[model samples]
Target: MRTLPSTGPRYEPPRPGSNGASPFLPPLPSSRTPIDPPDPIEPVEPIEVEPPPEPERRKLRVVDVQDRASLGGAALAGLSLTWVLYSRILPTEGTLGFIVCWWLSFTAFYLLLTGLRRGRVVLADRFAVLLAHSGAALVGIALATVIGYTLIRGAPALMHWNFFSQDLRTAGPLEPLSTGGALHALAGTLIQITMAIAVTLPLGVLCAVYLTEVGGRASRLVRSVVEAMTALPSIVAGLFAYVVLLISFGMRLSGFVAAMAISVMMLPIIARSSEVVLRLVPSGLREASLALGATQWRTVWSVVLPTARPGLATALVLGTARGIGETSPVLLTAGYTTYLNLNPFSGPMTSLPLFTFKMSQSPENNYISRAFGAAALLLVLVLLLFAFSRWLAGRGRSGAR
Candidate 1:
């Protein structure tokens, strides 16, 4: 207690007229005393920022003036050098040889000029483009040459109207172009091909459906067999038909037998090609169809087949093209005949290819002209069939959309 110095500030009671308050609490702050205001906020100056620079635009050109100039210079130089070489250095005498030499020289000159003008990467790109273009040009030139040659050789026979209406029955190997026609061969071709298609179409489509929509171990085996048959020689197919139908089954040789042989060749083509087309049908369509409570077969029938109709037509065309041009198969299965026979199962028949082959063997200008004419006719017939198929496929597409 030794005068416990005042441990706390002395507590004072409220004075009169003062509001009553607790004495133990600290005194309230006096309102009259000056209080410093918060320092005035400074208005911030906004910073000016520069936008990032725009990326440079690159110009793409297929062939600029510089490229055209280089091509012209290279071509001119190559031609001149090749001419000099062929005349003064090389012993080449043919037009074909000259063209080949020119092409090689042109390519060499092109590479040299491009290398001098550009870097390695650009040089490689240009060279690749050149090769692609050159390949296309060569193909075009070859095709044009073949067509022109065929036309020139066939023009004399094709000029006769009766060449399409009459038959070789009465026309001899030395007969004039106006005497004989390809009617019998044309009719036989149509009948045989029609029969082959009738036998192969449903079988091929079903096989494709089985392979694509209901794949299994059996499908794999079937696929392997189809692939093998795709490579089966035409002669082998004819021999198979010959042995199985003509020898073993006692079936007579006729257009019907030829149809069977053609069917053997066409079936694998249609099946394999159609299977590829069916596979291209989107899986999303199948899934959506299944989601809507359709069964697998129903989905494939309703969605997949319709969707791939155009490609199926193309496959059919391919098969037809393959079978129609076959010479050995028709020669072996359908014996050559000059008279028109409507019944495929009755008499010997001949197709366009067979007719052409037979006519070509005769040592006469008329026969040779007839052969060339038949070939041209075959080409035209194929073109017509292709166009018709394309039209039908286009119709399917428009209807689908």
Candidate 2:
């Protein structure tokens, strides 16, 4: 390439709207440039966001058990119960299999529950609970149905006037089984139970009141004694009554002696139950009563006792149930007689339980049937008493309210 001259004039291109003129359009003022002024800068704003609330933790529910486990437990429990029932009825020698089945069923249920709860929500857990509950309900219903059926089957012998009116002296298997009633046994049971209640109720309530209210330094000793009393065997109580009342006083077996024995059995149960109920009474109510210028006794009677009446009644009913069912003590204390005896102190009296015992031993099938009927009747009486106690308690509660 040839070298160019160093001092030559160079040509230049025209700028946009130079000299206030445009090549394609009208020209603008020379002071103003063709390029627009830089646009005003705007401040940048930061983005806003909120973190989500923490996820709630799932709670365990009763229904979370695995299906296999639940079924197994139910099966085991059923098998065990059946084995026990069969053993009771047949006096079987091989109890091991029954026991094993029972335990296995229970274990299976537990396993099922554990297996079902993997990575589940609270609602899902309830399925296992419902299953268990339903199983229990079904078992209870089945047992009740069987008992009711048996009781009904045996009740015909109990319906006749003679069943209530005639003594065992007049009753023979050959004699119309429907002719005799359990009136004498009924009377004896009533008398014995009434006497037992009379003896136990005041003593038990007082002991409980003392334990809950007045007992301080000696409370532990009292509690220990009460607990010991609770464990006292019925036969032991019967023997005690026999020794104390019958042997000591040269008294023959009678309703009174049986009543004393039953009272001894009932006292501890009543005391323990009453104490629990009394303790459950609201402290605020007691304080309020005291603040209102009521004495401690007044406060207890007016506020505490009234509030705990329902539980107290329940205790009484339970005590009566226990007392009425006691056969050993009654057998030891009250000599059974076929004839009706109204005098609790003088003659041997027959109670429903004693009558049932005696009747069961009879060689005749009729007597056995009568025994079952008597048992059913006894159960019904207990239920009635329970209902009555509940009704009374409810009424008292409503009145308080």
Q: Which prediction has the highest TM-score against the true structure? A: 1
TM-score of each: 0.77, 0.66
Steric clashes per prediction:
0, 25
Best by lDDT: 1
Instruction: Give per-residue CA lDDT, model 1, range 34-131, as digits (tens).
Output: 44555544545445567678798777765678788989999999999999998678777888888888989998998898888788998999999999
Clashing pairs in 1: none
lDDT of 2 by residue, 95-177 (tens): 66565555555555554555555455543454466568868987998989867965895588766767666666677765557
lDDT of each: 0.88, 0.80
